[model samples]
Target: MKRKLLVTAFLLGALLLAAYPMFSVAASSGDVGGLIAESDINPRAARTVESYSLESSHPYSNNFDYTWTITEPGATQIRVHFTKIDVENNYDYVYVYDYAGSQLHKLTGLYSSGGWTAWSYGESIKVRLDTDYSVTDWGFAIDQIEYEGGGGGGGSETNVLTDGVTSSSSLAATGDTEMWTIEVEADALSMHSVLTCGSADFDLYGRLGAEPTTSTYDWRGYTSGGEDVTFDNPGAGTWYI
Candidate 1:
């Protein structure tokens, strides 16, 4: 039972960003020349669950200035998603920092729901809360913190999936799906994806604006053998796979 799934995408000139799920499984024997080293990149374990969470002190605290850093040994990238935010409009703030302590994002006021920090490079990121002695509110809660372990972090401004790149991953168990993204520009020739799964069966799904699932998807490669999918004159924007 081979545990590896190799996916190769060819975009005439579009940029590709491959985001895989993490698994504790051993490295696959299959070739993955295009993927970052195993030590630096850990894809999500499963699409169904978000990884970790970070929350400000309940109701936060006045005159508070503290930082929390999340680190994964070899993570190449770290992303934070805020599910809720309720801090003083301008008197208080929640700041996000990269491994080197440089400011990355700031969350303030009540309308900060569903905000995501720009992707941070390196294995660690710092979240700091600075409050004045005036007022404080419910603060914020980060529902998920995603990190891709291992590699020489930083470089590309965006996680573009390079053209004609081959990336591979080993799914440790059943029902594991790796997620990836590609930014397709207008009037491009075409975008193609080739999925090669060893003996194990896997399904490929794609959507334009959001993550795809077995039930809802814009394109699917359902055959038992390796699958191929392509889009011609595809719309401009992000395409999830």
Candidate 2:
């Protein structure tokens, strides 16, 4: 009886651990929506403000009026999906700003004709409305701007990686290597690079100067073709140019 009880407890714990990952993945994948504030809108005549209807196939089908605002900019990403299609063919716009009202990015494009379309901004400081259009009897939807980070660690500007040298042909080749260049910059943090091949297996290396020097880092594993690869920052360090 004692042995049976122990086995059951062990099985339950394993099941719980497996269940956690499944739940997390499901939660991360889904649709999100919300309102926009009046202040974030750019004062340009080219800007068209419309109401967002998450349920409508055409969220901005007609002239709808409303005002909304976002308190935090760096933490929001505005998105809009269209539901209706007409000869007018207006496009949905998404904008972002920092806490100080600095423009971050803007995306303007037409939504899917009859399918669900989405746009997103990772971290923003605040957002505001661009129009006073009231939306009634429309099928448009607006999602609450959610924040998506580039992934773990600090922003790309601060982290740098220097993988040691292997060979010129070792980097991933879509077809040509001349199109590639090593780039780096600073924002809130630094970032580094790790290369992966898309067609052939290759080794990746990094260094600290315009040319390969005495110091370098090699990838622990080789990436295969058609594999999505990521070059993560191995903390803050000097990288080859």
Candidate 3:
């Protein structure tokens, strides 16, 4: 399939300042990439490394998966700062996870602000990149910072997600789906979600008060550009996407 591919790299941990600690890795098989561990880049109560870059194999390499991991057993909080990012809007993206492997956040062109920043909630961090055979971009680059004693962690919260308020995730390629949970107020007028960001093509699916799957979705939206999936007075409990 001849596709307009976009090429870019991911947070594979590249040394910015000399003597700075970092690591990098790449994977071409399966949906998830193997974790790249580097002699424990997490420091304890000491200023060891500055930043790490997660780069891709090459621009528009078609399909590939890359993974990067940072573990600070001492709860050494980590912060990620995005420098240059352009991931085909949403068709390609990097998913970030907390120390406990929770979906902390995901990034695409829609969420890219002037060097956006995110922090980890646990003692470790995992960044994985999944790309498609379609459009590509210059991927993304992030700087890693560690704080000792879990204090001064640099507002290191990476999840900018809000239920109906305004949050988004990405599906890197075909058969790629991003799932998350959101809270809906009691008997609210309506609870909704939208494809407010990203270029390419993506379908939005939701399951009110249930888990979302490609087949079990209660509400589905396959429209292009600013696709909005709204539910009138949805259940007051938790909703799946």
Candidate 4:
């Protein structure tokens, strides 16, 4: 009887050990880390193709500074694309900002004699600018912006437009609602926003095909007159807008 009981106990211990990995895998599978998936927008074939042009005295000024609040917090990855403008000494770039308006990612190096260029998604924070002596037109026809994973399966994402696109009459300056779209593949999602300059603002909206069920948030920033937005989801998804 003693030997039988000992054997039963040993068998139970082995079974638990075997079950642990499966449980761990299930947990790990649920946690794929934060990744910004593929993008729908494709770069223009010709860099010389000028699809759109900024209005005179647009981009707000020769020097532009703008900010985009990340409605979804804890985003680890991001993808941004833009249409390159044609001009002499023209430089364009994007910057990633934290909740406190702190610099995070600076993505630069896109110069346009003419054409469209896109920036790939990665983990970085700060402002990206053009490196040239003569000040040519510096701005891109921004097509789309995407965010991926971050801390605790959720991350904060935000962007600041500065020293580049500065005119109030520009497409991005008019608070153009038709510029871009946001998508989220997670189970639940949330968002918030704040506009500093009345003339220039970051207008965010969802697509028509599919949408997530969650609360949208909006808050005003301490400075710069912009709002801080935050969005949260219950679980994960293949994509989030």
Candidate 5:
């Protein structure tokens, strides 16, 4: 006899959803944590090939203080992707500020390439470089500015998965939960799901039939980026996750 089950994914905090695949049901627009118009909700933009460049003072001079503002009118959130960061650790600093002039991050020293700042709310974001007279290194560059389109050309996009495919999405605030449904086949041998949280930590939960809660979930993944849930000789029904 083929058993039926539902799986659900719950996030305790903000994070990215990378891959959720199996012989399962596709997530509908009405599903909890589903897509929304960029105008309605300020969701984070997925990293893309398109990029812009802003480099620090050439030769990495000393006593340099400069601020650059990047704006897209009506934009809800803004982010900067750092391609390179090499400055005197702690001595020299790069500051990130939001449109309201509130500080978001202070970075220094060397960081692995492709580091990015958290999404800053509003239409503008400021990046400033402050250096001491004593020492300096290669400095940093903002190679990419990511944000969701207020309208036209950027809207909610959904991914329908068949097998072994990944979909990317981001959640905002604490206790945010995004869910999807999956259907297992009678011949299916196993069901697996993976969640990859970048820079932030999140939790995943799964259950059969109805939505799963933090405590009521049948399957839970508690590791960072290492969260995985698999069922062998699985049931043949819809899973909510």
Candidate 6:
């Protein structure tokens, strides 16, 4: 009788050990983290950061808002591309705001897809997805790039830019020129500047000089929307854009 009882106990223990992993998975699958949770991402600084992807955790819940705020120095504008936007169609949507905290756009699957891209006119953008307490999907992803010179066409009168910082200003477009100056304190493998336009049409231009004027230009760029000027062996000096 005792031998039979020991054999039965050993069989029961083996069966439970084999089934524990399966049971644990089943339990976790139904229990999402919480009703309210937020994720914040701060990228590496000084170096240029070009792209980002964001999503809710597995088994996302309803009645929640996942907000993302990105702040970058030396950033003039941020371009966003929606790669995977699968929300609850009509109700659940993603909202985009500019650095001034103004609503730039509202996106959803009804009008957007994986290839749709948007541009923020300011240095930072806040993205949020709000869902009702109903159905849920896998959420969305946005890839972003920050351009330094605020996109407006460069004008003539040079404005000095602080080292490794972005300055936001306006262009009057009086046919004069708006310029920015940067003094390189160290050697750089490459030097580049970007200009993005807002409303008025202006032409972009850049040059290297100890001092820049309308007549003394080493290089010029002619792009309506935006332009980039790069130098390969840009010896440390003053760069005007």
How far residue 51's Cα lies from its native spot in candidate 6, in Å, is: 2.6
Residues 100-198, candidate 2, lDDT per residue (tens digit)?
Answer: 446654333332232222324433232222322343222222332323323222221111111222112232223222112222222213233344333
Query: How would you encode candidate 1's per-residue C-alpha lDDT over 9-125 as one tens digit per residue?
Result: 666544332322222211123322212212222354311113444555566668877565554446677766566566798789878888777888676766433445666787667
- For each candidate in turn, the TM-score is 0.42, 0.20, 0.39, 0.27, 0.43, 0.39
Q: What is the lDDT of residue 83 in candidate 2?
A: 34
TM-score-sorted candidate list, best first: 5, 1, 6, 3, 4, 2
RMSD of each: 17.8, 18.8, 17.3, 24.3, 19.6, 24.8
- For residues 180-211, write the lDDT of model 3, one tens digit per residue: 45434453566456665445766666676445
Error of 3 at 184 (Å): 39
RMSD of 1: 17.8
Q: Alpha carbon lDDT of residue 109, candidate 2?
A: 36
Clashes of 1: 18
- Candidate 5 residue-wise lDDT, 127-202, digit = tens: 7778899976777665666665542224322122223445456766565566555444455666677766656667
Instruction: Name the 10 consecutive residues with the lowest summed lDDT in model 5.
Output: 28-37
Q: lDDT values of the candidates?
A: 0.61, 0.27, 0.49, 0.29, 0.56, 0.47
Which one wins on TM-score? 5
Summing lDDT over every window of 10 consecutive residues in candidate 2, give the lowest-scoring window. Answer: 1-10
Better of 1 and 5 by TM-score: 5
Best by lDDT: 1
The clash count for each model shown is 18, 60, 24, 52, 16, 13
The alpha-carbon deviation from the true structure for residue 5 of candidate 6, after best TM-score superposition, in angstroms, is: 52
Q: Give me the runs in candidate 3 sitting further than 4 Å from their true place.
A: 1-49, 58-60, 110-116, 150-241
